[model samples]
Target: MKFTCEKSILQEGISTAQKAVTGKSTMPILNGILIKAKNNEITLIGSDIDLSIETKIKAEIIEEGNIVIDARLFGEIIRKLPNDVVSINTIENNSIEILCQKSRFTLIHMNGEDFPLLPSINENMIFSVPQRILRNMIKSTIFATAQDETRPILTGVLFEINNNNLNLVALDGYRLAVRSENLSTDNVISAVIPGKTLSEVSKILEEDDENVNITFTPNHILFNLGYTKIISRLLEGEFIRYNSIIPEEYNLKVIAKRGDLLHCIERASLMAKDGNTNLIKLSMEEENMIITSNSQLGMVREELNIILQGQSLQIAFNSKYLIDVLKIMEEEEIVMEFSSSVSPCVIRNKEINNCTYLVLPVRLLNS
Candidate 1:
């Protein structure tokens, strides 16, 4: 394969595709990028069987051919080269030549035929949402996905579509984050997409109103973004029946300034961090909420004025869990509903129901 293109264009395509490269020593072909030159376009693809990212860039195709080159080495070379037109050509002995402003290099290229074929989804279940909306949905819930591999299904976020609403649900054993958005689709679809794959797609998605078309298959999910597309295998197995776990009603409801509560817990967690459990207690009274933490080194006590309703109660939780939810929330004020100190605390936007976060509290020992 031979092609000449601007450095910036080539660099971006390589960088995006490189993210999907899984250099499994056992399969060297998986580490190489498949490059095809035709129709005055250069298509670059990188894949690891499970996740694949492909991008197309306009380039002058001199000799129409295809080759697979080492993703890491090719990316490093193109990135460091001068910002000028780059020319590449395949030579004898299965090697390729690279030339730029004044630099030159030659590397052995792998046979493109050996690369695994990327799964194709044709005329599948197609739906789309604004890029910004999808990006925001992923960021708000991805953090709650379980990091441990104990339950593989829990490591992926659930993409559920029912009626005209889309919900992204993620849960680690201790916390749950659910972000919802309204769309114009009436199709019901459910898929468990890996968090790692979704995170990469989020990086490539532009924060604009442009829609990203999504195609779903029984075994795969594809995110098609005009010039680029991401394909990932669906995680097998059933996800937790989340709807049954959350309480329908709470004994107490408290409305407080999100920033004020977040800051108070942050300061108190400093002391709580030193203890085995990152515990913080919230003592809610008729007119005031007291935040306190006890540790081996010291204790911290802070107070915030809150609007209380229903009843007054006290609850204890891990400071980190609350901090995660508060940091991602964009609203000025938040609503917290508590069934009891032992039950989970439900946090939601004060004025809207776009997002719901549930945090399981750490049991407090009687002293």
Candidate 2:
């Protein structure tokens, strides 16, 4: 393939597609990116069996052809190219030459026929959501997804669409994060999308108000974002019944400033970080909440003014878990509900019910 394109445009296309390139795959073709040039447009594709990314950029095509080149090498060369325009040409012996200003390099190309075909979704179950909103939904819940592969279902976020409401749920057994948004659809759909894939999608999404078209099938999901498309396999297993696990009732409610609580927990976690458990104790009294942590390194205690109601309680939790949810919240104040020191603590926005985070309290020996 021969094409000449602006360095910035080429770099972005290659960078986005490189996300799906398999790093240590047994198939050599999977490590390379497929480049296809035709009709003034060049497409870059990368796949790792489960996930694939393809992006197109406008180019000056001299010779319309297709070739597969090492993704890492191609990306590096494009990023370091010292000119505004870059020219790529395929030569004899399965090699491609890259030229920009005074710099030139040749890279051996792989057979494009060996690359696996990306699954195409032609189903009628397609929906669209604002890219910014979808990106926010993924970021808010993806951190709660389980990293362990033992229960593969929990490694993905549950996408539940009922009528116009869309709920995204992610839980790693210890914490559950749920984010809800309203869509303009009436279709009912449910799918378990891998969290890793969602994370990558979030990275490439633009911050503007553009809408992303999502197509879903029985075993795969496709996202079309203007010039880029991503396809990923859906996890096949029943996700845990998350709604039933969320506590319906709590006797104690504490409303506190999010920034104050976040800062206190961050300071408390510093001491706890030295230990294996990273435990921090929260004691809610009449009008104040005290956070304390003790470890082999040292101890930290912080007090924040809070509006407490219902009943007083003391609970211990992994400091990291609390910080994770609190850091993402945009509200000025947050509500924490607790049935008891042993029950799961629910944290949410004080004004809106758009998001909810449930964290299981760590058991104390004395309790």
Candidate 3:
């Protein structure tokens, strides 16, 4: 394959596709990025069996051919080269040569046929959502996904569509995050997307307000946006029935500034760090909340006054868990509902809309 292209264009595509490249692989071809040039367009593809990302860039093709080159090396080289045009050609013995300005480098090529075919979804459920909205949904829920490999299904986000609503949920036993958005789709479909894959997808998506078409099949998913299309394999198994676990009633409700609560919990977490899992104590009184954490070294405490209604109660939770909820919360104020110290603490937006964060509390002296 031979192609002369703008260095900036080639570099951008390589950087995006390199995210899917398998860093450690037994098969050498899996570590390389497939470059195919034809009909004046160049396509770069990288995959590691489960997740594949492909992007295309306009190029002036002198010869129509294909070659596989190491993704990491190609990205690194192109990124450091001058912003001039780049020339690439495959010569005898399957060595790909790169020429930019006065610098010359050669990359070893692998057989393209050995690379595994990416999963394709055809005639599957399709929906479109604003790129920024989808990115926000994943940010709010993906962090709650379980990392334990024992239950592989829980290690990903559960995406459910029903009656014009799209919901994404993640739980790791200790905490759960649920977010929903209204869409025009009436078709029903549910799939588990691995947390790692979704994280990469969110990162690759540009910050523009463009819309992305998401399609799901029984065994695969495809996200089409801009000049790149990403395909990821779906995890097999039944996702846990998550709705049953959420509490429907709580006697106490407290609303406070998002920033104030976040800082209080963060400070408490520092003291709680010496303990197991950084446990913090939350005492909800008539119209105020006291946040405290104690360890052998010292104890930290703070209070945040808020508007409240109903019975007073106290609860204890992992400080890190509360901080995680605050990290993704975009509202100015948040509401916390408490049933009891032992039951889950439900945190939601004060406006009674958008997402819910259910966090299991840790045992405290209140016991």
lDDT of 2 by residue, 240-302 (tens): 999999999999999999998999999999899874688999999999999999987678889
lDDT, model 2: 0.92
Between candidates 1 and 3, the one scoring higher on lDDT is 1
| Residue-level lDDT tens digits of model 3 in 1-367 | 8899999999999989998986887778878998889999998999987889999999999998877888888899999999999999988887989999999998779877677777756835569888998998999999999988988998999989988889999999999999999988768989999999999999987666798999988888899986999998888999988889889998888889999999999998989888467888888887789998888999998999998888888788888888999978999999888888899989999885879899998876548
lDDT of 3 at 177: 96
For all candidates in order, the CA lDDT equals: 0.92, 0.92, 0.89
Which stretches in model 3 have alpha-carbon errors above 4 Å? 123-125
- Residue-level error in angstroms, candidate 2, position 365: 2.0
Model 2: residues with Cα > 4 Å off, grouped in runs:
none
Candidate order (lDDT): 1, 2, 3
Off by over 4 Å in 1: none
